[model samples]
Target: MSDVIVVGAGLAGLCCARELADHGLDVLVLERGDAPGGRLRTDEVNGFLLDRGFQVLLTAYPEARRALDYERLGLRPFYAGALVRHHGGFARVADPLRHPLGAARNLRAGPGSLVDKLRVARLRRRLSRASLNEVLEAPQVSMAEALRLEGFSREIVDGFFRPYLGGIFLDPALETSSRLFAYVFKLFAQGEAALPAAGMQAIPRQLAESLPKGAVRLAATVEAVDRGGVTLAGGERLEAGAVVVATDGPEAARLTGAVETPAARATTCMYFSAERSPLGEPILVLDGEGRGPVNDLCVPSDVAPSYAPPGAALISATILGIPPLDDDGLEAVVLEQLRRWFGAQVDGWRRLAVYRIPFALPAQPPAVLALPQRPVRLRDGLFVCGDHRDTASIQGAMVSGRRAAAALRGSDSGPSCAL
Candidate 1:
């Protein structure tokens, strides 16, 4: 029997197991898929490396300093500024450092009315100062209500939050709690949206390498867990001192019998290779006209030179709130939206890959804000970890995993670093 049997091979499970193993505890990781990455994955097609969707690695993630090697990973970055197209015109939303003076000029002279601009500036400052913990614990308020109370106009909400924030959470209704706003602002304020020179999968691959070889079991679907041990999909049973369930929220509930919560929203992404690329140097084109299922488009080659072929461009389209059953429809919608943006280029572009994630992001309602982290003890030998236990990002998953390890070690005397 192993000292610890960690269920799932995602970042959370990997991080938790790595920590425990580093402390000289025997750890085994079981994953249903052939790989370790949960959502941070990549696909190769025709010499092009494509992420499951357009995802940016945040350099400001708190867990990276301890859990990952950012410098060695070759995390190439894009221009922090994004080009936002609204109505009939487009404007450059510059980052603070990239074009500090220019950003000020645009913020002062851009499309918004005097009152609208002032309101946004004030709200931005307030959000920056507010602590997410305070908001999450105090009351469960919606973004719409918060914006209304702050006197933000409907136009500003639609033009900015609807497409931008919606793309983040995949919810067009904008019902996400304002508590998440702090995390979102942190990504922008730190100016750290980037992509690995290889692909997003490099992240999980790096973390997995920290463990002993043969520690992770790929395609080992877990069917049930008991105080004694865990049962595999084919009726194979293995014993362990403890089990850590590191799947997503719904899966965690299924394993531990916790209160049921809704599954995460899904995303639909499509990749196209163009002979003569219509996209420019900037990595992100936000809210471009007719960028429908394609709310945001990014040319990965702009950020990471190794992502595409020598002459071809890698164009990625991302849309939120896709149903698992609508794979074909998602692909068609993304392609149609691409056609609207680059009419002739769309014709010459070759379809590279299509990724439809049924559970791309957990639906973090206000109710979940109050939920404690996953129970580290299910009888004498069980635990759980995932983004649902904390924030629902790379940082959250890693943090949850590490916390689970600390709990299992269960004493300040046993390897202080392990905790």
Candidate 2:
């Protein structure tokens, strides 16, 4: 029997197993998927890389900086700001600090007034000065309310913040917690949003590769879990001294019955291959006018050349929620929207894939942020950890895993049993 068995091979499970193994404990990780990364999976179609959904890594994530080797990942960064599709054309909104001249030039060209732009600068300054903990500990409220409290104009909220941040939280209504909003805003200000040249899966692949040989078992589904051990789907029982349930929120709640299952936020991402990118820069495009289903769009090949073959560009379009339409119908609507934004040139883009993720993220409202870091220790010899246990981001998942490992180490003197 191993010293511990971590059920799930996502970021949380992998990190938990890594910590335990590093501390001289024998850890075994069982993953249901054929590979690691969980929701961070990627696929290649027609010489293009398509992430499971539109996701990015914030370089300023404290846990990420501690856990990931950014050098090895070969991180590619997006531009500091986004292009807002406004009245009949696209308007640029560059980060004032990074592109001071561009920001000044576009002061009246984009979504909001000059005062609204100044307010953005002030908000950035205030959040940048505050620590991560301070940001999370701030007053709990809906994100919309928080923006209102910051004195931002409705024009800015609708045209820029809605499409930009809504794409992040999958909450176009901006009903997510203010704490998360503040924390994410601080991170964006402090660092760049990047992607691995190889793909997001490179992150979990790196973590899994660091573990001892045979430490993680792919295609190993755990049908049941107990303090002593876990039962595989084939009825084979594996024993361990402790068990960590690190699956997604719903699965964790199902196995442990000790976790609160957060409501899921759905999303759909479509990938297209084009001879050339509509926007030749590595910046994100936002649907500021809220005119169509495409909430945000980007050319991954622009950010990372490796994402597409030479002479080809990979475009990713993100829809906030799952629309009640078949794949063909969805594609038609998305294509129509794109044509409106980029003209007849959009017709040359070929559809690659459409990923409908019903559980892209766990919904984070004010109540969820009341306790940013939920308890990872369910009881002696049992633990639970995932993004749902903390903030819903890569940082939260890894941090929860580390916390679970720490909790397990603290209970080392407890009675030994198969986990």
Candidate 3:
């Protein structure tokens, strides 16, 4: 029997196991997949790396900075701002601080007016002055309402904020909590949005590698969990002194019967192979027109050349929610939109793969963000941790994991909740 049995070798589970093992506890991690990364898995196809979905690592995430080695990951940053498709053409909206000259040149040419640009700067300054906790603790409201209350013009709200923040929150309506919006905005202002040289999966893989050998067991599906231990799907039982449920929200709810299953946010990502880079720069392109299907597009090879073969470029298109179309139908519409953006050159891009993730993230609405950190200790000898228990980001997952470890060690003085 082990001191702790952590279910789901995702970011949360790996970090929890790492923390426990650091304190001399014998930790056992059980994962149902063939590998350690849960949703962060990457599949190599024809010398190209395709993540489970299009994802980016915010370099300023506090938990990630503590848990990951950015230098080892060989991080690559996207351009400070996005090229927005607006007014029947594309316009550049740059970060005023990062690209002062560009920001000045395009202040009158982009989606938002000069006043909107100033407002963005003002908002950035206001958020930067407040701490993360202060921002998260501020009054709760929908992102849409927050934008409106900030005195932003309707043009900027629809053209700039909708597509930009929509791609991040996966909420086209901007109904995500303003607390999350402010926190994300602050992060973006503070650091870069980047991808690892190997892929997003490198994140969890790094965490898992830091643990003791034989600590994690893949392909071990835990069908049931009690205070004593877990029973695998193959009818084998593994006993432990304590159990930590670190799976996604729904799975954690199913196994522990104590977690409240938060609603899921979905997304679809499509990859295309092209002979040459379209944008010729490592930058994000957003559909400021509020177009459907393709919300944002980027060339991964531009950001990190290793993402594709030497002679080719890897393009990723992100659709906020799962489209109801079959693969063929979806590809057709997506390409059609691309054709409009990049002209007839889109016809040369070959479809690589399509990933539809129904549970890309746990939905975080106003009510859900009410308590930034949920109680991780469910009962005596039982605990839970995942993005669902926190802010629904990589930072949330890691923080929740560490919190679970602290509670298990009896070092957490925070109030505990009953199962």
The C-alpha RMSD of each candidate to the native structure, in angstroms, is 3.1, 3.4, 2.3
Sorted by TM-score (best first), the order is 3, 2, 1
RMSD of 3: 2.3
* Model 1, residue pairs in steric clash: none
| All candidates in order of lDDT, best leading | 2, 3, 1
lDDT of 2 at 407: 86
Q: How close is candidate 3 to the true structure, as a TM-score?
A: 0.98
lDDT digits (tens) for residues 194-266 of candidate 3:
9999999999999998999999999999999997999999799999999999999999999988888888899
lDDT (C-alpha) at residue 397 in model 2: 91
Worst 10 residues of 1 by lDDT: 410-419
lDDT of 3 at 270: 96
Please report, in order, the local distance difference test score of every candidate based on alpha carbons. 0.74, 0.92, 0.91
Candidate closer to the true structure by TM-score (higher is better), 1 or 3 = 3
Give the TM-score of each candidate.
0.90, 0.97, 0.98
Put down candidate 2 lDDT per residue, 1-419, tens digits, no spaces.
99999999999999888988998999999999999999999897777889999999999988889889999999999999999999979999999998898898999998999999999999999988988888888888999998899899999999999998899999999999999998899899889999999989999999999999999999999999987999999999999999999999999999998888899999999999999999999999999999879999999999999999999999999999999999899999999999999999998988899999999899999988788788889988999988998889998898888888988999553212101
